[model samples]
Target: MPPSRNYMTERLPSPQLLLRINTLRDRALAADSLNALAFSMANDAYSLLQYHQALVLALQGEQAELLCVSGLAKPAEDSPYLVWLKRAGRWLNQQLDGNQPVWLARADLDPPADINDGWAEWWPAGLWCVPLHNRAGQRLGLVLFLLDAPPPAPLPELLSSLWQTWSYCWQALDSKRRLPRWNASRSKLLIGLGVLLLLLLIPVRQTVLAPAEIVSREAQIISSPIDGVIKQMHVRPNQQVETGSLLFTLDETTLRNRAEVLSKGVAVADAELLAASQRAFDNPQSKGELTLLNGRAQQSRAELAAVKAQLARTQVHAPKAGIAVYSDPNDWLGKPVSTGERILQVADPAQPAMRIQLAVADAIALEPGAKVTLFLTAYPLTPLHGEVLETSYQAHPSDEGVSSYRLLASIEGEPENARLGLHGTAKLYGERVLLGYYLLRRPLAAVRAWTGW
Candidate 1:
């Protein structure tokens, strides 16, 4: 009889046994753990083979094949069963397109005849092979088995069920391996793009935006005109004043008294001169007396004028229209002011200007009317636009151990509240040239000067 007829002749499982098998199948299907599902399938296959007097094996793929044998004995590395597994892997790769299942019997097992001589003594009589495919329908591994003796009948339904369960386990394992690699590749790509964008933005900022502006030190001091006591101050600190506005008064009481005494002497000299002139005209012999009196009167008048002028200068006035700034007074209030001592500053608020100190080398290349942009520490948000108004022909020594030219620029649209001596920096645009010239100009100039190239 054929194997199919023999399998049918065997009695069908009892209802109770059928119910238990169904329960185990349901539990395996609902299992959340992939390992649990794999082990459950392996155990079920083992039980069925034992009851039916056969052998079974399960296989998983790594770099090499892993075989879980359920038979009369465990196979050694050189055993016939392991040799069959290696051959099965090669055959499955060729015939299955690495997908689907392949079943084998005595006629199907095609090991070399010489190798099979030992297999007849130690190996099982029957063989079954199933290819394990993932969800993508790619072969992940193979499952194989050998029976202790030829199965009483071919169990096609059992083999089909085993193939289905093995496929699910392989798919779960493949999913776990592939997801992390995909996520890592995606993350690296995004990070690289972000860094590239930041690098691209750097040059735009350097070329289009203005830099900070600075003021030179020499343009900011206020000095006194003469030596005298500061008797009264007419203006407060930071007050705005026009040219000739009185700022303070010095002690002038003594000068005023001297002026009054000179005035009385001038009056007496004038009366004497008038009397002498009248007498000279009335009597010719009085001519010498008239000349002496006239000389005396003229000298008295000159003295009076000198004393009056001295008194007038005792009050101090502004030299220019601007915002007044008092420097460190050094607590000198009500004290005498010496000649040329700086008392306060009067900065031109309406026509505010900035000074740039350029190195002698840089200054030589700069010409008047070159563009400049100024940035003050106090007003960082707005830039003061201007052009080089003037450049000193002579260079002055600087703290940087080099000589520099003082370049002046008139600040455009002077701010309403900008004070004198506010700290700032200036960037000179120098001369216009081509983009290529801009890049090579500095280096070439330096090399030519250094090596005569």
Candidate 2:
């Protein structure tokens, strides 16, 4: 509660105290570090003052961390005595100034009950505190010595001179301890970061990968002309065929059965009309009925003709000479198809083009006539190059189940080397952008999607 006791105005110490002060001065000067000097002041240096147990602590952040204790190599921080000592150290750190030393008893501290309860159990009398200050007058740490009895004459004068001797060496070690650890790597780190930034700024062409296949530039889609189950496939995928060739046929059993029923009804109508004509000559009532029978007979013939025409359409034929492109014939053998459902493609194998399905998420602004590179799974070594001819404005679900934009690219030079229906990976190039943008585009897009930014 009171200011630190002032001992500077006291008379000079006697000869015996002078020799003791000089002995302590030699030990402080020879000390190598703050920890070593603190240890000596708590242990061997106790001859300068009468004290029992002692503690050496460093001020680290808001806590007084134990460094050493008298008669022990390491301080037992978990022990009840040290735990109570730490609580008392916190109160002392807040109240004491580094200007002078102070003697603290139980009433002087009036610490919290937790710290107060264990003080009498650990020490017999009062505690003496000496704060260590750097050259800048900042409190570095403190030393606590437990004393049961009063120190002999001239103890204050001797302790004041001893503090001056220890502070000089403590300041030198404290300065070195506070320096930056990575002094050697700072220049190398700065150079690496600068180089990385420049590399990111370099301009590069933006590209995207999409599944592609070699197809005809002008191909004909062969769709089902009637609603029926496919009975057979006459042409296979990539098979050569000519005009008027049977491409495929639907199930004719249902149409054939309908035609047979219509034919029998037509014959019965003609027989009834003949019988009514004969009766018309005998009775006037029969002549009126003869006209009705003739109309009925004509209607039956029309129905038969319609059924026959449907039967003719069951067998489909190729309209042009080209190769047929479709999947496994077994997949369509018993599958029911609707009218206008596409079954296969009739393409000219020599005039190959690229059909690329670019996913909507990976889509970039691509102009017509943009460069395209195709690496076929079969012919990976010989990459075929092409130019974009068309790109769909809207996205459609592809076979891969992802929404994609369909792209058609025209093959450069002769396309005879490549065949239709060959699958590959296409590399489509767009306008130039910063290398950083090209590399980080997907990651940045994912982050935006996650953050909704």
Candidate 3:
């Protein structure tokens, strides 16, 4: 058999204990309406537990103040209970480490000394101190009930359970007050990521855009056949001419004079030869003289023939059908040209190409057949398309005093209204690549060059 049980040690709640617990739970659940909830909890606790008063002191960071008061019609700031609460707050914070409710019985304060303004003398016979904490273990505040007698065991346990749930609601209210509604840094980070993704997905042509000009695809240069002074001009600068058209005539005054002189010399030699032949027929010793006279005549005739040929070539003719590409015609009218010296160019206007001078700094690796589009200064609204045919192996200084490489591009077809020497800009398209790579290629190249990395 079991020993006789000690019923006095295990106290039970009264019949109305469940009703009081339910009422407190309802108040705690409505903690979002904090002021009303605090008042309701305080009044209900006072009436249900038969306490002298109920008080809720809210604590936020380092601040502590009375939230609500019950069981007093005219509660004053100088009230002993409030004064005692203010004085004991620091001690209460240190003792409520685990956030468990502190059940203070009448026997516990027997030897208590005076507190703030001697408010310790007004201490209740028994009290319940429930320290409220959120689920994360952050202290919300403290709830105090001034007890007329020790509360039933179930009442303190029930209040502790209700406050635990109420702690969450209080936390929500605190967060709403302390935390920002929108975070600028978070928003900025999202925007930056979106821009990066957009840039990666978008595509653009990887092209090297440079200035260009329209030029003859293939030109024929006319040069002087012999050293002579220009005596006559048959064509104007930039004028179109057909094959065999006389282009220019060199001075022929001295040439004609030399030819006439040589002719007279030949005539004199022939007369001498005839006389020598007659003598040779009369005397055998005169045969050598005939041979000498004949040789002299032959030499004079050869010299005369050469002079006539020179006179004929004095009038230069067009080699092919094309425009006379030269500066002012007056520049050549009285000019003396050396043998093989270039006089002008005959370029077919129908066949046009692009000549580009790419700066060394702006140059990129290029392959044959690169597509190029030209926008002429004279026709900005029009564009001419072509393909790269050749590129210089080395760079040369341009008129602008910058080192550049020259490239030749053939037009896809004969462009309407296009002419030789038409100047414009060109865009040379290269292999496809990412937009970021295309944009940063130059800057990265510069950095590498500067750092030698």
Candidate 4:
């Protein structure tokens, strides 16, 4: 006889694992209290396996009642750690049904905010869960081992054996048990489902809110007609003005000085040509000098006329009768501007329209003639209605650096009430869509981006 042929002993793992399992099992049996045993099982199991943390939850009344966590003697019931752990345990219970161990990852849960998106921050990348079953084959509790690295090849099987034995002892020590599942009335369940379906199917308008401002369709933009420094602003911002009303002026000192210098040069050339003509009547050599002097006189006069033209352009004026729209006059004062650089807009107050900046992230399918409602920031209660008059095919960066599409909408009623450059939030309505799609559109898009499916 060879050591009495113990089949159970031979079926056990290597000696190292066997010794570790036996050690944890002895500790579980040695506990004198339920809390002590729970702590031992929650913490002491780490000596036999490699894991960063552990969570032990007991099944109570169809809910996972968290008993203890590794490395903590006692944690408050309402602590954030325990709250999130309980949610994880409930999700694990649903995942586990048979008397076996399972590996779970973030992808399996598709965690919501309640479960917290920062799963990896609190837990480890590698997760192993053991669903503890009673001798009657009913799920009694759960054990979670979080690992930062890969587990040993024999880790799961050995841990399973040790967990099964400890769990059996734990159930014998504790009095609470899992409640059996209940079946509700079929009529009531069906009615609730029908109501939920009807609610989800309700039609709702697809809407996107974007930053908007009251703009003019036919406004004349007053720009710097020449490259010069802004000298004066004749009309205040949003001030009423008639056609040819002075709006602003550039620095005319430089142009005026240049014109004066050229005018004097023309006078000098005329004097020189007249002297050359008087000398030409006396000597032939003076005749040649007269032609050159006459050419210089004509060139100087042409330059003087050009300088006067620039001096006239320094004073910008309103092209059409309307309100002047621009930033603070102080900001533009002493500011050098290039020719054709926009300084202000002369917009017709009676023909105000909405200019919406729809961000790329919030952009929806929009076309001309779409319905729009603008709620001014100052007067949010009274909304101005409009229809989309034009939409840009491409996206351009807004002042805030957000890429957005430009939309022009016509104000239907009380256009006179809407002032040019007034800021507001525009709600652009699209074709009617199901309520379910309207609500879940963003969430589904996020999930699809995450899963690439």
Candidate 5:
């Protein structure tokens, strides 16, 4: 005998099962909403199949939603089974294998494969997966029938027919209430076309964007030679001063007093030595005292000369002709600074370069002579072009506390208005790439980081 005949003869649906399926079909036809339709269908399947749970899942975009659940303790949306159901539904919808419904039993599936094993813990013994479709033969959704015992031989064929009838009823009712819409196939095709157009037409630049500031190439820093308070500032900030001009001066009162004290000590020691020398001529015993006094006088003279040199150094002078680059001289006035502390910088206005701080997340492989374009905050309309001079190998924290790599770029041509300390945005260009890759590069990198790929 043929398999179909043998299956039907062995396990035909009981009269009660037939009656329940008829009732379910009538209810599905009369269902007002998609939710009501799914619930009625699941209820009928649970009653006839003697299943522990029955779930109806519908696919929307990249996700699947639990439309209705029967034999569940709580609402379908709040059930733990909902999570697994949605996950399983997505995979099932994407499957390209044969469309035949699956009847899985624990005995038959000793070592379950694919999605069957995933839900094995919950279903444990046996279950049936019935795929539903619309009139156009497009996959609409799936109906999951989970049972504690293995189903009858003909149960798969019967349940498949019943689920098909339920789908037809849902379609008839839904069509009357709603207008026609594109199926999954049509929507996917449209999206593919849109993506293709974007890839062909869109122009995306592979760039490393960073915060840049105008810096002087031949900048000379003026540091505090000695720890002292500033008494007076001679040149104003950004002022063009010649070499040897007094840039600033420290309070010389203490230094002068120290010098004076040293000088007095030196004079006294010299007088003592002269007296000792005269005594040595009269008494030979004074010769040892004369040597001691002479040594003391030389030490005092050396100390005094050193104090005088320090006193002269109290007045700081400009090293070379350049503009004084400082914010406010008043802030530095009376401020006691430590030795080697930066007081100010003298930068040549003629030589300017762009200093870029590239964020760690935004860093890319950079090489010397790579093109860089800077859009100054001051001059938004104008863009100054440059080329990369060098990039720091190590990453360090920026003033904002974000780790970043430093890049130095030499401006191609001098922009007349660009000045030192001008802030701007810099775009460092790298190798050309497809528009799709350029757009998805960061997002893909983030995904890779999250997944530890």
Candidate 6:
């Protein structure tokens, strides 16, 4: 019907060719399934190893191991790699004690030459050891993986992502274990003993007396004297300055000009005085002229001196040695300033002091020269010795609706670095009451006031 197809143009496949394609397809499918299974197993093993590593590290143990289904032999004890592992174990222990994560790299591992010889060809060169922590966050052991050469690439990625699961599992196991229970019991027992000791020592503290701190005068705010364009600023914010030292200079062009004019006027006045005296000696009638010249010379000299004195005020000098604190300029630059506009403040570091606002009732009990302890927020450990220098007699209403008196205290032996405006607590040592009263006074007062009891 198709005009008979030519034998040379048509072709047919032999049965052997069909069989070969089917066989190749079967092999490919099998290989894929095997790879997937191997990857899954590797991931599981890695997770377990990580957990064990963490446990050993937390315990400060010198050894850790990750056992697998393959029944790999333990590393040789004498091997350098083994030594490295021991070091890592020690590091892990330290980290755990410090409550930090145990992170060890391939460089941390000491391996036997032959140990990796078998797997060297199959695995990456550099391996990492990750510690696994139990539910109690205790080190379990380690998870090992070859970083340089990963198996199938995807396997390593999968293992790394799933490694956290091992930590969770181990942590659960630790929680269910008996070791934690024993530790907790021991801790409670120690706490109970401590409480008993504290109760017994209460009376002993009453017998011993400590040197009382004396409250001193509060620091005063040092304000700037003059305002002008700050030509030369010598000190920075909080920089210590000395008395008579140059703090800064104002634009003194106007003053400099006045000084120059006064200097010329003084020279002219001196010549006129000399000439007038010579003429008075030469002629009797010149006496009147000489007297007039003398008066004019004296007036010119006085004016010149006054102008020079005014010029000296242009250079800003420190009034006292202290720290320099700059005030906000408020967008003013080279602008003229009022007579008392502050440019900077110098706080005396050596004479550190603090001001406290106390309730009027508390202030009534506080007397001048009373001892007090100052505890700055910045230096909580170091209590500053202080004495009550002064207390305001008048009670003023505070923003908090409380009538308070300002109490000034001079801090003794302050550190060189202490700055102004540092907030601190001042504990005033009121008249020495019974040791028992001193200890419970604050709490009792608060309770009495709160409960109206």
Residue-by-residue lDDT tens digits, candidate 3, 158-206: 6666776667666766666675766569789899899997897667768
Report the alpha-carbon TM-score of model 2 versus the true structure. 0.58
TM-score of each: 0.42, 0.58, 0.52, 0.59, 0.58, 0.39
Badly placed stretches (over 4 Å) of model 6 are 1-232, 267-284, 319-321, 325-347, 359-362, 369-375, 378-385, 395-404, 410-419, 427-453
TM-score of the candidate numbered 3?
A: 0.52
State residue 17's C-alpha deviation in candidate 6, in Å.
Answer: 79
lDDT order, best first, reads 2, 4, 5, 3, 1, 6
Ranking of all predicted structures according to TM-score, beginning with the best and ending with the worst: 4, 5, 2, 3, 1, 6
Per-residue C-alpha lDDT of model 5 across residues 324-439, encoded as one tens digit per residue: 99889889999998888898898998989999999999987789999999999999899999899989999999999999999999987768857888998998998777787787
Model 4 Cα lDDT, one tens digit per residue, 109-202: 6666766454765886657877877777878788788876556666666666677777778777765443656677999899999998899899
Comparing 4 with 6 on TM-score, the higher-scoring candidate is: 4
Predictions in order: lDDT: 0.62, 0.85, 0.79, 0.83, 0.80, 0.54
Query: How good is model 5 by TM-score?
Result: 0.58
Worst 10 residues of 2 by lDDT: 1-10
lDDT winner, 2 or 3: 2
Question: Cα RMSD to native, each candidate?
Answer: 17.8, 11.2, 20.1, 16.0, 12.1, 23.3
Q: For candidate 6, lDDT tens digit of each residue in 1-453?
A: 354555533443445544544443333334333222223333434332332211122233565442321222333666655555555445434444432223333344554454334334433444444556555655665544544432443333434434455455444443454354344687899998988666654542221112122222322344334545655566666677778878666677876777788778778877887877787787877777777777777887887787666567666777777777664444344666656676667665566666777775454366788877766677779777667788788888765677877777776775643456566666777664454554665678889999999
Residue pair clashes in candidate 5? none
Per-residue error at 322 for model 2, in Å? 1.1
Highest-scoring model, lDDT: 2
lDDT of 2 by residue, 1-453 (tens): 123334543555667768877887788778787677777777876666667887877887779877778888776658877777788788878878647887788866677777777777777668777888877788778888888655665677567878877777677766677866775587899898999999999999999999998888868999999999999999887899999999999999988998999999999999999999998888889988887999998999999998898889999999999999888899999999999999998888778899999998999999998999999899888889989999999999999799999999988888445877789999999999999999999999999999999
